[model samples]
Target: MIEEPPTTTQRSAEVERRRAGELARPLTRPAGPIAVYDTVTDGMTGWQFLRTGRWLAYTAAAILFAIICLFLANWQFDRGQQASADNAVVAANFSAEPVPIELALPTLGSYDASQNWQRVSVTGVYLANEELVVRNRSNSGTNGFEVVTPLQLSDGSVFLVDRGWVQPSPTDALNPDSIPRPTSGTVSVVVQLRPSEAPLGTGSTTGNQIQSITLPRIQQTTGGDLYTGAYGLLNSQAPAAEAGLTNTQTSMPVEDVGTHISYMVQWLFFALLGFFALGLAARKVHRELNSDDPEERERASARMRKRARKPFTDEELEDEEIDGFLPLTRWGLSSGTGTGSVAGKTVGPTAAPRVVSPAAPRMALKQDDDAGDREQGD
Candidate 1:
């Protein structure tokens, strides 16, 4: 008894099974400096990705990171602009005519650049015991301290006054000789109105030395109805000792525009990088799903896998050969054959047999006759 060749249907089914098996095999890529194309192409394609919740999560995360970076960049830019404006205000009002303290002070939150470093006059009794020493203050490149004493105004409200810089004694103690003593009675004082300092959560709490002079913190610590702004004493009406004490040093806002600009550029770069990478991945998936040629898709996938391998080290380059790292070839795949069959019809490279036209045979015969005639003529 003889057995018949497998029918076309059976062959098709077998091919489908082989193709499915090949696809089901896991692809493993090593960790290293993988190419962007490899990173994009090595994942699930098209609808497979769209149908999964993981892909949505990944896309959302990328977008969120880009937005956060952009927000930080904008914040830095705004801060730079604010600094420039503050510097301008300091320059314009540093030596201007004195204004009344009430005219500069706002009824609400805090005084801004409009009042910062502006000279003002006020009559008050200095609260000697409630003074705070600003630690680690430097003047003329020498480490010293600034005494912040509160002045009790006639209206019963208190104003924190940054008196002056003072040098410590030889024993590192608060030197009475360093600080100038305020007059015994209520007196008129000329002071430069300044913005409240930033609150400090850290630094020395020992003795009278405090890290910062924020008005709110002072109000809380010293139990006083304090003014929103601080005053840097310029001069006292009452006769004062000519000590080495200097008025509060007005600080210049840092005008480092280049640093903030660089940071903005960096954040923008990160946003662009994330967006383009995501687009590349989406494009790769679209191509893989829409392509009609299965063999081409497989080859592309294999190329991506090869590119995803770990980068070669100097030692590995010297000791190991990379020639043996080839992927499984097209020759062994179901779609590898020269003749591709569909619904019992053969197609592709070997689809049709080559047949010479009758006109070609007649032309060849005429050529032979012409050769014979030429031979006779010769």
Candidate 2:
């Protein structure tokens, strides 16, 4: 007697069991321990790039870059805030009442920014021979030099006075045609107090030409107890009118917050972009190392090999492409040998066996040309 085929219910139960078995399997393979190889000796391998150590390196580099960006952003923000504060101070004190020269100058130590731009008056004799010209100072877009003269006070102290600006001689930068001489004898001069200049790099000094106006530098050239800060001549009383000098205009520093803000924003953006790029790289490597599907894993590996500019190993070379789908083996009704069809038929002793050949290389599927032609003709 022929045995009855499986009922619908039984087939449904079997399909469910098969599905559950598949689901029970791991979705991805486990990544084994990292392998160490000498990049200089053996060169980098596919395994080295997919290894855990490389991922760790990627993560570390990304974090370091982000940290540096954050530091730069904070630094720019601080500079912007400082600039704003300095601009505010200049606006408030530019036109304030003048103070006594003694009150503005420090008696012994350094003076702070609070004394900057305070108009003051000093009565002293101009040490004309000791006057030094500050190089590279400009006025009204004209290249010039600042004439810094030493003022001898009655109490036996000397102060450096930034008398005014003068045009450099056409022949020499050091020798100017003439610098306005402060009136001879003890004369009272009204001036604006400014903080002492920070000393700069050492350079060759001839006669009175100097790079900057710091107290220590001036003392090295002309020994005396000079004021810690210098004065900008707002008005000067002289014995005789001097030629070839121009009064200097002291403009306040500009408040530029927008440029710093833009820099801060750009740095933060770079950090975020770097982090995202690292994440993408990690994911791609992870897929290459761990995907459970054989085809998908192989594809991922091929991509990595291409990206790293590495050739395939001997074992990994394949002439035939991977087939996406497996052939249908058999139906439950019969063995179905020799391409025989068992449409709604019960399996019995007379049932035929079907033999399937090994799968061939994958090729692009196309419709029959004859069938297409017939359709077109119709």
Clashing pairs in 2: 183-238, 183-239, 336-353, 336-354, 337-353, 337-354
Model 1: lDDT of residue 184? 61
lDDT of 1 by residue, 259-368 (tens): 77788888888988888888787666666554544665556545534542435455543332322111222212222324332323323332111111222333333343
Q: Across residues 1-378, which tens digit of lDDT does each residue of candidate 2 receive?
A: 555755657544544332122112222323222223445324433445535565677778999999999999999999889877777776766677666666776584556676656677777898888888888787888777888888888888887777788887888866665666666876777777677679765878677788887777677657667675564555545444365566675565567889998999999999999989987875555454444445654454344334323333333223212431122122222122211112332222222121111222112111122444588789
Backbone collisions counted per model: 0, 6
Point out where model 1 deviates above 4 Å: 1-58, 106-113, 123-132, 136-143, 150-159, 173-177, 183-189, 197-228, 233-241, 255-258, 279-378
| Stretch of 10 with least lDDT, candidate 2 | 357-366
After aligning candidate 1 to the native by TM-score, how far in Å is the CA of 25 from where it should be?
A: 29
The C-alpha RMSD of each candidate to the native structure, in angstroms, is: 17.9, 15.6
The superposed Cα distance between candidate 1 and the true structure at residue 170, in angstroms, equals 3.5
Local error of candidate 2 at 236, Å?
6.2
